[model samples]
Target: MIIVITRPDFFEGEAAKIAQLLQSGRADLVHIRKPRASQSEVEQLLFSIPTELYSRLVLHDHHSLAIKYGLRGVHLNSRNPEPPAGWSGAVSISCHTLSELSECRRKPYAYMSLSPIFDSISKRGYRSAFSADDIAAARSQGLIDERVMALGGITFDKITEIKEMGFGGAMILGDAWR
Candidate 1:
């Protein structure tokens, strides 16, 4: 299960690219993370993609769009910490620290993303927060398991290590859109 996160800003042909990813099976899920876009703008983007693939796309903002379009899920971030009222479908969240990851164990989330495992390509100077030793230790302690995904700076080259470290999947942002 490889999840692809969209860029922060929208660009021409972006919807087509997202559709291609889903249609080609290149991404099991595509997270639309446009934080500043208007609801209408996001709807326009959604209208461009095939309706059948809506279930493979998750929204970072305008979660109403997710419910309206029957999207895959909603991603919780600092901007939107809770799912929409009565949202009962698949839900995921971002966790930046190991403690946050550990704390998420009791939640009923579909999965949780633990990020900054490597230097970020999309955000300059956003370096990795966890060392390999820390990751190994977390795995041995049963904190990193099949419900966790490695996000930030993920690329084709690191998928094997991510799997070996006990992550269920890799959440790709900078690497996938590049």
Candidate 2:
């Protein structure tokens, strides 16, 4: 799957246009990660998108809106490490280390993003935590699989490389937005 995460800051005037374009294109999922936005702001953003596209969105904050808006799922990050009690829809998270990935495999997530597979395009100086060799080794050891997606600095050119490294898919941010 090709997932696209929204930039943390709201896109002043182009948010709806960009989101609609992505929804009409190849993005399998769109993770809305507006960390500083209020619940009302998030609701407004959601309202701007067509209701038919609601099933393709995943909210990073105000998860209650997932049910309120009938979104595809909710993404757990540092802000929310676990799903609220009785969250029955799809849930996913970010794993920074092999250990976390291993643990996530035991959960019922649709997929998990294992990030910084390459230097971050959005975050300066955020280098990859694992090398190609490390990725290969992890795959060999059964740590990387179709449930773990590669994130960070992902461009069209890197998709094949990420697949070769045994990631299920790539999550596009900077590359897609650019």
Candidate 3:
């Protein structure tokens, strides 16, 4: 489960890059997380990508596009915490704490992201919130499992440690864009 998160804002040739990542199997899913973009802007970006690969795309905003384009899923975030009404497709949420993860596990979701596992590279002051002891305790209690993805400050080099920590995958942002 190599899940990559798109940059917050669209960049030149961004769609092409996303198409390549999915087409080449570099990412199992790519979450399109433009918090401030217009619906038309997001639509244009989606149009640029090949229709055959739509199943690998997950919209973080303008979730209507997911249904309109038959995309893989919609991501739940602060901007769009609740999924679209009556949406039964693949749904994923973000959880910053093990408690949140534990609570959210009752719902049927495809996966969830645990963030700030390390000091963030994208957000200047977002330091890690969990210590080794905390993570170990969570893992021992069956909190950090395969359904969880490690987000924030994730890079290719840290994948081994992430896997060892029992994460299903890593959701890279700054390192990916850089």
Candidate 4:
């Protein structure tokens, strides 16, 4: 489960190419996290990608488009903490703390992202709140497990560490773009 998250701001000429390449490669899931994008904007972006790869896409906004376009699922964040009624396909969420991860695990989501596992490569000044020891302890205590995917600042080199920490996978953002 190697996941790739889209940059918040769309890169006019490069985003589609990168996304297609990622989908064709090892990314098991691709979270489309354009928060400021309108429905039309999102649609346009989706249109750019090949229809055959739509099943790998997970929407961070305009979730209704998931069904319309046959996307993978919808990702729940602070802005939208729950799935809209009638959403029956795969779902995912963002958890910033151990407690939130614990709570979200009880739900039937495909997976969840435990963010800031390392200092953010995309967002300046967003550092990890959990230490290596903390993650180890959490894994020992069963707090971190197969359903938890490490997010934030995850480069190719950090995947092994994240797996060792008991995360199901790594959700890449900046590293993929860079």
Angstrom error at residue 178, model 4: 1.4
List candidate 4 segments past 4 Å from native. Answer: none
- Measured on C-alpha atoms, candidate 3 has an lDDT of 0.89
Q: lDDT: which is higher, 3 or 4?
A: 3
At residue 73, candidate 1 shows an lDDT of 96
TM-score of each: 0.97, 0.93, 0.96, 0.94
Off by over 4 Å in 3: none
Ranked by lDDT, the better of candidates 1 and 4 is 1
Superposition TM-score, candidate 3 onto the true structure: 0.96
Q: Rate the local accuracy (lDDT) of all candidates.
A: 0.90, 0.85, 0.89, 0.86
Q: Write the residue-wise lDDT of candidate 3 on 1-178 in tens digits.
A: 7788888888998988998888887788889988989999999999999999899889999999998899999999888888888677899999998889998888898999998999999999999999989888888888888988999889978888999988888888888678
Cα lDDT tens digits, model 4, 62-144, are 98999899888999987877776788889999989989888888889889889888999999999998998989988998878
Q: For model 2, how does the per-residue alpha-carbon lDDT over 79-114 read when each residue is reduced to its tens digit?
A: 988776667888999999989888988888999898
Candidate 1 lDDT over 33-128, as tens digits, reads 989999999999999999999988899999998988888899998889899997978999999999999888779989999989889889999999
Best by TM-score: 1
TM-score of 2: 0.93
Q: Which candidate's lDDT is highest?
A: 1
